[model samples]
Target: MAPKVTVLDYGAGNVRSAVRALEHVGAEVKLSRDPQDIREADGLLVPGVGAYAAVMDALKASGSLRHLGYRIAGGRATMGICVGHQVFFEAGVEHGVRTEGLGEWPGVVERLPAPVVPHMGWNTVQAPEGSRLFEGIEDERFYFVHSYGVLEWNFDVTQPAMRPPLVTWAEHGAPFIAAVENGSLSATQFHPEKSGDAGAALLKNWMGTF
Candidate 1:
């Protein structure tokens, strides 16, 4: 049977593109705000677009965040896109407010310093050796538009880190954590759906993992 993947809907996110991407990859996909839908999914895709605090609150209010932890802890495959990636960290320091994150990974979501509030446009990403998601996918460019990025994390050390530590694949002239993967959980600060062929291939690779 094809893996059933759920694209989380927290109201603060635009899940249509992700849903289309997953469908394009041959997986059975659904847009769900219910906790049960997430619990039963073979893989989960958390996609978001909006402020850190508002998105966090929407996830909690929908009860998807709590169930997301359950899915990850159970060894199920999961992925976070853009702001969705930020919410996986311990907290987000945006707009002078500190909001709690899912804390699945040990990191803090912080804004890019001066001259780089929102890193927009297409950029390249290099996956380190032995990365499952980047198996056949080469160093390709993808679309990214975001103001905040994952600054640092301790979770990468305790467990086997994915991609690389402290190396920026491509950014607005500065390096930052572009992508991260640990076990079955993975995240990228870019929009794979908007990345054209390269991005589609990356999404295909992720679904193929299951």
Candidate 2:
């Protein structure tokens, strides 16, 4: 069966590009705000741009946030790109605004402490020991354009409820969370859709999970 992927536009820009990338990886893609379609989707992709609070606001207003949480909680595959990935954390603090995230992982999304803001361009990532996300393309670089990221994975590894996500890290001024794989939930701080061939491989690997 062809992979069915849903790309969400929660008031963030550049969705058509994401849809195009997903399509390039041989997945049947749809851009939607309808809760039913999002809930029933084989894979839910939350793509975002702009501030954390703004993305959260649009997600709440879209009425799909609840469905997103429900579907992921039920062990359905879901992917978040860029700010979409940040919103899956506990909270994000941008310009003094504290926005609550989906809280699927233990961490805070805050600004990168780099000499340059908006750490843009292609960079290499330190993939986890055994990650399905970076599966055969570990040496390839990915595109990143963001100022905020979760600097560390903060969770009690001893606790079963606090299942630590398989995390990938990258460096700008310092190391930060790049991608995370938690069971049916996966996210990337970098824009896979914009990262060229390596991005395509990552997307293909993700789709192959279905």
Candidate 3:
């Protein structure tokens, strides 16, 4: 049976575009806000375009966020886009408001400070070796329109000096973590749907992980 991939619609996501993109990749995709739908999904894609606090509140109220986390932690493939990516972090400091997040990835989300608030336009992505989400996708450019990014941290407790480390992919005006992959969970600060051919291929690669 083809795996049913669920695109989460928590009132804060661009669910339609995400679903269409996933479908284009030849995957069985569904746009759902129901917990049952998410629970039975083979993979989960969280697409968003909004404030962190608002998105978090919607997920909490709907009880979809917690269930989604459980599914991912249980070894289900998951992907997050843009603000959707940011919400997977421990917390967010956007627009000067501090908000707690899903705590899936250990890091803090903060706005790209200074000269650039929202880093918009096409930017190149460096896909590190062994990245399944970026298979067949070379050093390609993708569409990005975000002001927030994740601050990578060291997972080992013994390595205190190496702890709270940062893993940056692309450097715009400054270095920022654009894409992150931790175990089965992966996320991107760029919009693959709006990224044309390269983005389409990238989404296809991610869906293939299921």
Top-scoring candidate (TM-score): 2
lDDT of 2 by residue, 31-123 (tens): 987777788888989998889999999999878788898899889899999999999999999989898999988899999999998999999
Evaluation by TM-score, superior candidate among 2 and 3: 2
Structural similarity to truth (TM-score) of each candidate: 0.89, 0.97, 0.89
Highest lDDT among the candidates is held by which one?
2
**1-210: candidate 3 lDDT, tens digit per residue:** 666888887887567877777777777888887887787787888888878888888888877967896788687888889888888888999767899988866778877764866788998877677777677776788889887776455456675554232233766666677777776677888898888888889887776776
Q: Write the per-residue lDDT of candidate 1 for residues 45-156, one digit (tens) a residue.
A: 8888978888888888887767887888888889889988788778998878899988766778777764855788887776777776666666777889998877654545
Root-mean-square deviation of each candidate, in angstroms? 2.8, 1.1, 3.1
**lDDT of all the models against the reference?**
0.78, 0.90, 0.78
Candidate numbers, best lDDT first, in rank order: 2, 1, 3
TM-score of 3: 0.89
Estimate the TM-score for candidate 1. 0.89
Give the true-structure RMSD of model 1.
Answer: 2.8
TM-score of 2: 0.97
The count of residue-pair clashes in candidate 3 stands at 0
> lDDT of candidate 1?
0.78
Give the range where candidate 1 is weakest over 10 consecutive residues by summed lDDT.
161-170
